[model samples]
Target: MDKTLRRWAPLFVVPALICFIIAFLVPMIMGLVLSFFKFSTVTDGVFVGWSNYKRIFTDMDFISSLWMNVRFTIVTVFTINIFAFFLALLLTRGVKGTNVYRTIFFMPNLIGGIVLGWIWLLIINGILLPKGVTIISDPKYGFWGLVALANWQNIGYMMVIYIAGIQTINRDLIEAAQIDGANSWIRLKSVILPSVMPAITICTFLTLTSGFKIFDQNLALTAGNPARKTEMLALNIYNTFYTRTNFEGVGQAKAVLFTILVAVIALTQLAATRQKEVEA
Candidate 1:
């Protein structure tokens, strides 16, 4: 049976592999290749070497969008993790209706991103209407709106991870710390935190990547209104691709650069967090 299963394993995987190649790998490679050429369509592509890359750097909108995305990622990552960790700690205690609360908290994550953006847009605008303003009326408002929307959606998901990590901690270790006359703060600092390092790493990575890749929310909420001030990297790439004619190569170049940027940041974050986990 084992030998038969092993023999058929490749057969079972081949279909999925083929689908992935056609759906993702092929397009990704094509996009990378197209980034070095100029064209309105694949068939008409003309080799342009590094011109597309040069145009990407010179585009002020792209530069601003990249910076905005970086800022949003940093802010959202910290806010979401901190809040989620605290909520996890709370619910893991003797709290009543924890299951209900968990369900309620996590429901936001179940909503589609575009829908979430529109919902927040209405809610935020309703609040700001009293002050005679709207979310898209200013870049700062749009920035904070995206931050708030991201935190609301992600905090609950991160909380679940934290709870699982907290539950895995040895109660005996915590009791041992208490017996040594360690206060709650001391125990939390020296034991509970270290025990939850894995969860922290996972949550941070998710938040970081999600924050950086934000697009639907930015689009539904602001669509880079008031002169593209609130545009993020993903949305900027999107606009460059469709909104401007004959700039598809530049857009593709921006996308390749965006992919590299996200890869580097995520790898750096994982390395740093994994080191902390080992130390802890």
Candidate 2:
């Protein structure tokens, strides 16, 4: 049976491999090739070597957007995970109507990003109506607005993951901690947190990437106003690609760089988190 399954493994994997190559690998390779060439379209191409990449270095908007996303990622990752973990703890504690509360919290995650952004724009504007301004009126407002929107949408999802991790923890461990005179706080610190590292890892990765790659919310919420100040990296890349003419190669180059940046940051986060998990 094992030998037969092994023999058929290539057959089982071939379709997915072919699809991946055709859909992703081929396009990625083409995009990379295009990055080095100037083109109005794929067919009209002229090789420009490193000029497009050099332009990225002088692109202050790209730099600003990159920084904005970094700050946003830091704020959201911390806020979302910390809040979700506590919320998960509360819900896991034999609370009444846990399912209902979970549903209420999780509903925001179901909304599409564009829809979410509009909903939040209305809600936030209403809250700040007396201030005589809007989220788009100030970069700070836009920044915090994005953060709040992200937290509201994502907390419940992370909470669910945390709840699952919490549930999987051995009840015997809790009992032992209690018997050994460990208080609730101490037990939570020592046992609960360390045990839920997997959930932390998953939530951190999701929240971090989501924060970095946010485009629709940035578009609908502030549209990078009051003059592209609130634009995040994804939105910036988009503006470069579509809004600017004769910069397609430069835009493509930016995209390749963005991909590299995301890959590096994500891998670093995973390695750092897994190391801490092991140490814990």
- Backbone clashes in each candidate structure, one number apiece? 0, 0
Cα lDDT tens digits for candidate 1, 1-280 = 8888888987898999999999999999999999999988877999999999999888999999989998999999999999999999998886889999999888899999899999999988998899898887889998898899998999999999999999998889998999999999998899999888778878888888898888999999899986999999999999999999999999999999989989997889878887876876
Superposed by TM-score, candidate 2 places the C-alpha of residue 2 at a distance from the truth, in angstroms, of 9.5
Off by over 4 Å in 2: 1-19, 269-280
RMSD each, Å: 2.0, 2.4
lDDT of 2 at 148: 95
Measure candidate 1: CA RMSD.
2.0
Error (Å) of candidate 2 at residue 103 is 1.8
Reference-based lDDT, each prediction: 0.91, 0.92
* lDDT computed for candidate 2: 0.92
lDDT of 2 by residue, 111-207 (tens): 8999989999999899889999888777999899999999999999999999999999999999999999999999999999989988888888898
